[model samples]
Target: MNPQALSPRAKRRRRLQQRQTVIYGLLIAGLAVAAAFAYLVFSGTVPSPWTRPITMPEKIETSETMECPPEGAYSVAFGSVKANVFNSSNQQGIAVSVAGTLREYGVTVAEVGNWPKFLRTDGQLQAGKAGIVAAYTLQQVFPTMQVMIDDREDASVDVILGHTYGEQSLIKSGDFPAGVEIVPPAECVPEEEPTEDELNDGGEDLVPEDEETEAPSDGEEDAEA
Candidate 1:
């Protein structure tokens, strides 16, 4: 126990033992730390890039819409319009009859109904700015038809047949404007962005109270005119 009396060899052995003890302690502590980290990773309390599941980046939503006539196009197909035919005359079933005739001429007749409030000598074609070109296209089906602008928001046009609306015989097959490009109506102002309105609304609009359309029964689809 007298340190001064201890041999030099003995002191050296004691120092070596102390060094070994320190090395073993450090090794055990390092192993404990590694074990804790592995437990945390397996329990999902800590994220490990190597062990995590592979995933794709989130998808971004786009606002692009599909329109029938398309945007900023100079011309449109004549009979490509969806028309709502209204009977402003005293004749019964005339609207339905005219709608069938329009369908035969390659126009998509949206609805057939009665609206006697129209007083124009020439049947009027009405739609929002988005449908102006479509309105003009329908006008060829009814040569004396007038194109009127409204506040609605789709490419659908309202064809209010006046008393002077022509008979079936007068609606010629040649009036289909077959393969002919339809220029925008004279009433459509250049500054008025019709095509853009169409895109913004995405070619969809609420129905008007006045439009009580009776669409023909098509087996392919069931939807409004």
Candidate 2:
């Protein structure tokens, strides 16, 4: 078709058709780009533009510190060490039974009673400044027991039995075993805070959607009115 042979109205219609086709193509390309962006966001392949960058704290180096007895601090004999037995279990007379067992091991029973709160583990040996050696000695007697440092100024150690307290001691002995070494106390390390993604991965819904209320019947509405 030659331009000279075409009418003015026909040329105008052809130009309008070309413009419409170009606009439709542009719309389709924009839709395709939008769909790709949405896919990336929903699939977690790329972070959303609205999200802020996270800055983690730098790691701090901690040196190992020790708290030990003074030089020439004599180790007291187990027979001379006094301990208080507290029952945190439901079993009756458990404190007395444990105290008797301690006596058999040559440890003096200072007191036998119930603890203020129940323990979570098998047992715990609460030691003070002067009772560190005594606590380790008790740990030697019960290998699975936990040692906790407390604020008492004296040498007395508190033995609290938990729910898993068995009637008999795991280690059988007439006298305190030799060659038991005491471990010096160390400072605790702080735990790191969780990241944003880690906190969001819990999968728990904090707020639930409210259910829609059913519409009242005409008769019921009229009666209420």
C-alpha lDDT of all candidate models, in order:
0.66, 0.69
TM-score per prediction, in order, is 0.46, 0.47
**Cα-based lDDT at residue 129, candidate 2:** 58
List residue ranges in candidate 1 displaced over 4 A. Answer: 1-75, 168-170, 175-225
Candidate 1: residue 221 Cα off by (Å): 70
* Alpha-carbon shift of residue 21 in model 2 (angstroms): 99
Cα lDDT over the full model 2:
0.69
Residue 170 miss distance in model 2 (angstroms): 3.6
Count clashing residue pairs in model 1.
Answer: 0
